[model samples]
Target: MTLRHAAFAAAAAMLLMGPAHAAELEKLWEIDGLKQPESALYDASGGVIFVSEVVGDMRAKDGDGQISKVSPEGKVVQSGWVKGLNAPKGLGLSGGKLYAADIDELVEIDVASGKVTARHKVEGAVFLNDIVTDGAGRVYVSDSGTNTISVLESGEVKPWLRNDRLNSPNGLAIEGDAMVVASFGKPAAAGQEAVPGFLVEAPLSGDSVRTLGDGSPIGALDGLVVLGGGKYLATDYIKGGLLRIDQSGSFETLAPLPSGTADLSYDPQTKTAFVPQNKEGKLTAFRIP
Candidate 1:
């Protein structure tokens, strides 16, 4: 069989052997009064959740963006907890600092005082989408528009990986020595819809990138959370759904969500997921089984 046909065949086999039943998604509570909530991060030590909101145009460097604090039980404790940001999309917490992926820079905020302490600008960065820490005091941010991943190590910012095959990488998570990325897909035209995304595993020690599963399209994948045992929970940004995928690239639709399901935070303790519906301006909590 040709490469394309072989890929399709493998995908078909995966579909047949994937999970027969979808997980139960029980709605918990919803937080309203948010403007384009883009990402959610759970603070385990503080027992709170921090959400990023792009109050203005995502590409525009307007100072209307802000971050909010939500209680564990789904209350907006402080809507404007930290303000004066510009289109903050993703968030990461490391070493008592909350890092935000702003339009062209990574903004660092002091977690204790909730104050903007530093801003590390990425040279030639256009759209920095997702931010994550590798548990080693290193902050990694994905620049989708530039097709690059920038790293902040030892108080410096530099481009770590620049690969055109990334295809507008969005959500990111560190798995072992590799960085698993969820793509937003390549744009069809200057002002057209994306081509649908998939998952890719890129090794931190090398420049190689390998597609997960049969390399078939998943969706406009947004946020990604590793669910241990070689499984993951991902969000489809355009199609509007939550999905569970195994190591073999087999996927099962867990729940259908509204469009604009952005970055998500999953708490394994309670089997709960905090999802941000940006266009709907709502933050919802769902129990996943």
Candidate 2:
């Protein structure tokens, strides 16, 4: 079946398997006119939001991608805070710098000056999607194209793990000594079709990757955030919704969203979620109660 038909089937299946309790999302505000906004990062210290826009093709190196600065009150502070990127997706903040996964490179920007301080290329990387940073200032990037996870430390980038079992990892989140990965599932092959992904845990110090729970397929997970108490909030890129997942691998759909919802950012203090609607060219803020 085509991707569109698959999406519809997924949505219908979700409705059939009703959630135990559907969490209501109060729409706080929305900022429109964005260009394929793929990821959002909440800067608590700066009291603002950073959005990465893939203005052109997702894999093109046309240098039209950029990061925009938005205010907490839903105002566009800077349309092109940091420009000249190549299909930038995920956004991470560490050591007073903003890191963006630009295709095969990690573009670093000084938070204060909004200047491109460095661009660390990932050798042989296909599509670098999501990024996360640990408390120790280590940045981890997930490459969806290569089913690999790479790390940046001491001003260098290197492949940390390359596991086929990762199922084309898309989002990365550091949880204590392990990194929780949101896989995009395997790519569509000649005789096989694409399937829904699941969550996995990879120890930071070892190569052993453990699949959470029974490894039941969730949707094509994109953005992932720790909701504390062994729970997580993830966005389903294919099914088009937000999911609340437990450590045991069971999950419930929280909210149905637009089809192209990409990476999600949450503000824990305010209990607000920022979702980037890539095809809609908008960033929506919702209060999760």
Error of 2 at 224 (Å): 0.3
Clashes of each: 0, 0
Pull out the clashing pairs in model 2. none
Instruction: Give TM per candidate.
Output: 0.90, 0.90
Write model 1 residue lDDT over 27-141, tens digit each, in one string.
Answer: 9999887999999999889999999999979898889999999998998899889999999999999999999999999999999999999999999999999998977899999
Runs in model 1 lying further than 4 Å from the true structure? 1-23, 190-193
- Please write out the lDDT profile of model 2 over residues 1-289, one tens digit for every residue: 9999999999999999997664677889999999999999999999999999999899999999999999988999999988889899999999999999999999999999999999999999999999999888888999999888999999999999999889889878888888999988865689998788999999998487889778999989999998788988888887688788999999987678878888999999898889998988989898876
Error of 1 at 210 (Å): 0.8
- Pairs of residues at least 3 apart in sequence or in different chains that clash in candidate 1: none
lDDT of 2: 0.91
